[model samples]
Target: MTDEFASLNHFNGARDTPMPQDRLRAIRHGAEALREQLLDDPPVHFARSFDLLRIPYPAWFAFTGVYSQQLLKPHMVHLLARMAVVQYDDFEGRLRTLLFTPADFEAGNETPYFKRLAEKTPKFLHKAIAPVYNTVPQALASCGISPAQVDYITYDHLHTQDLRRWLGTPGLLPNARLLVHRQELASVRGLLPVQAEWYCPHGLDGIAAERIVPFDGSIQLGRGLALVHTPGHTEGNHSLVYRTGDGLRVSSENGVSADSWAPLSSRHDGIRRYAKATGAEVILNGNTQEGSTDQYLSMVLERTLAGTSSSHGFSNVVPSAECSPHWLFPGAPTSHLWGETSFGTPLHA
Candidate 1:
């Protein structure tokens, strides 16, 4: 594929333009609103027979989408550091844990991806949110769960992840296995320089190859949860769909903010006009590996899978990198929203 439409390399196009003056203010306002929502509401919740916990990771900043840092100002877009844990009942009615975007996957300087990024890049524009950075253990503890309690753990993709951190030398979560897409595992085995530094070549180093549980495509993990294939962000990118109390919800990095996923809410002047005219979608997530076509289709698939969402005309697919402070720079830090629900009320964590 040509880098023009499918690449994670830093963009440096001369085609630059300033967003409306009101855009920045709007972004700040959104950040504050989301942050407040998270503070007021707890991250965990019960939906039917399942428990969902929205885990906040360290905040980070990086140019998002195609034009974010490459073609336009490096400060137009941002992503929040959000992850989730799902507690569901198996066919036998036994409670099982399924972690999405596990803490060991991304964020923090201790990670191989960030270490290399710090050494190789100049814009090392990321910050560890000391308040929430590496707080997954605490979050898990609050719910009376631990790594040993976890049945399965998965990330949408393995971009910035180093499995060794979680699996350890002989293996840490002895009872748990890393659920990953076969295609993604293949990609990780052969890292390309053009890809983001978030993916560490030695990530799976210590773990025995058998420890990695690979799947071919979309799957129904259980009655209440599923891992749907949506390969646009990467060949192995997937979305998590769950049956909430009210309806269905999805989680993926395919789209960053709700605005990116909610076409109805993305009616701002510049963005609206551009989206309508060019037939090209822009700034959906921090990473743009495949193309708008695949990403857009993935978005559509999320809604289709949702079937009946508590939301009106939109699917509930929350992105982890959401606390973006700027619109031009997708990686800039700002605020956070644990998870938006039309799905159901969150359980306290």
Candidate 2:
């Protein structure tokens, strides 16, 4: 109602004004420039990486339509959110921190807001162990960094967040801004009040409008990262594109797991047969109302091994580092295991 939803892509330049081909060309040019800079002068490069866990989830939740009809084996298998902390150098040659949601939720006597919300929510989620958080501050401190050093904060989508705790009425990361999709902010109204508890109450309310940067269509984050419009998991769902030394990597929840994104990695005979029959390389994020066709195309935009039997060998955009927060759990299903993590070694200055 803040005129954000009333007008599509109202805040930034908004992508609709330009022709589709022109926009695509601009994106390609920006990507090429960023790639050159990163590989040569390196305006933005991965500094280091760390992970934090929020709440544990069942394996079924990681894949769409898998175990939906009934519980599969490995009932004890658990899944949790892994917050990836990535550092970079901005175009100005200043060190910048970009946190992809450290999750930062807690349990028991740790956090009252989420604890209360959990009590009111359904019993299915209650089965997982209480969340593990509250160490995020110490974790940052150990890195010789503080919230103030952070430049940008984002999530794949606003499925759930405790961001307001650190990003308060005044501020925690004093200089940081929330880079999110305009459609995501617009879609919140349709979800809240009905599914209100899923969101942190007034979490984003106190933050100033300028502190929140919303945009439409495909947009570049600085010179190195591009946030692509891949709307399926959530109405405003987007993916983070980073040009790595290896290739272009994408980070998103559109596919709940690696196997979901790369069906060729699957060992399930049924899935293999289905893939063989349909040639579908992608699967759904399981919780969205958006169709799988769009999700599949989005997956196609992602990168995988070249010339492999399972890969299309066309995309330079590889799936970013993603790991289940509960990969260490005993008796965990094979599907719950992560094939790769976003954790990176230090980049040389």
Candidate 3:
């Protein structure tokens, strides 16, 4: 078995490192659970009984290391594997959808900086490698919906070039809007070193910026609602909130993966507290263990929000750093949701 497969198996707690049947079974089980939960409850606000469907965007590739720097070393193969779930209504209406930013398009492209990185950093060969297994086109095709019909494209923090490629892709809906934090757009313009590559020249075009709408705190896309929760990782990093039949679901795409749904306090205190206060039922991550999502959500919700704890104590308190005008208050959800605010006291409903 390859070292990579072995590592993944070990991480997944499989007895056999190579081709771990246990790991695959666990993954299948989790996928089935997610599908069942999504279908049974329909994770959106359905007033009455309605038909529902989910499209899985499989992970085609990943960077070897964890840190952004390590993953960024090879300029060519920086794209990460991602997936999306599109939910439709009984009338075959596109209610709402969530998708990870497609980052693979930047691989093997001949950008000036990428060329320089390849020439100067020969040691970073692993970084330049593309997905050895699944590819994005195949994953998208698997959804059975032509790419052109896709209505909304929700990205975490994709490089400008990658976003351009995705936007240019034939399958995406032309009028489909791009959702991201306002600060992220500004950060892209500022050319900050930390996010230098993310700022593609394409984003510089006023047209590109025009096509992109700034997600102040929350915005309702065709069928889904998006939330802007900027953690320190990036100035504009945000999470997404979509209403499902079960209740409101929050996708911590950048903050957590599908597998780690531990109570906010146990996994990430700030995010946990924020999600709990906001009444988010499911916490989906960008990545995770096969069974972690079900386990974490089940345990954490039972102990935390569903338990006898006081929701009033930490429920509504927004840290000064994370405040924004559009942030939902109990009674007053924003109408013109845009702009940022200073780190001040919590804004109560």
Q: Rank the candidates by TM-score, best first.
A: 2, 1, 3
**How close is every model to the real structure, measured as TM-score?**
0.68, 0.69, 0.44
lDDT of 2 by residue, 1-349 (tens): 2222222121133233446445334434443444444334333456333444434444554555555534244443344455455666554555657776555454222333345646776767554454443355665675567677777878777766655655666666777778778888877646644345345544565667777878776665544555666665666767765555454556676665555655555655544454565666665555445545445544544433111222332233322323243533454323334432453443322
Clashing pairs in 2: 57-79, 303-317, 303-318
Q: Write the per-residue lDDT of candidate 3 for residues 165-252, one digit (tens) a residue.
A: 4554342445555666776667666764545643445533434544565655333343334343323335455544343433334433
Candidate 1 accuracy as TM-score: 0.68
**How many clashes does each candidate structure show, in the order listed?**
25, 3, 18
The residue-level lDDT of candidate 3 at 237 comes to 54
5-85 per-residue lDDT for model 1 (tens digits): 111111112012255224333333432332232233222233312122222222212223324314333333334455577
**RMSD per model, one decimal:** 12.1, 7.1, 19.9
lDDT of 1: 0.52
Error of 3 at 341 (Å): 36
Supply candidate 3's per-residue lDDT for 317: 16
Quickly count the clashes in candidate 2.
3
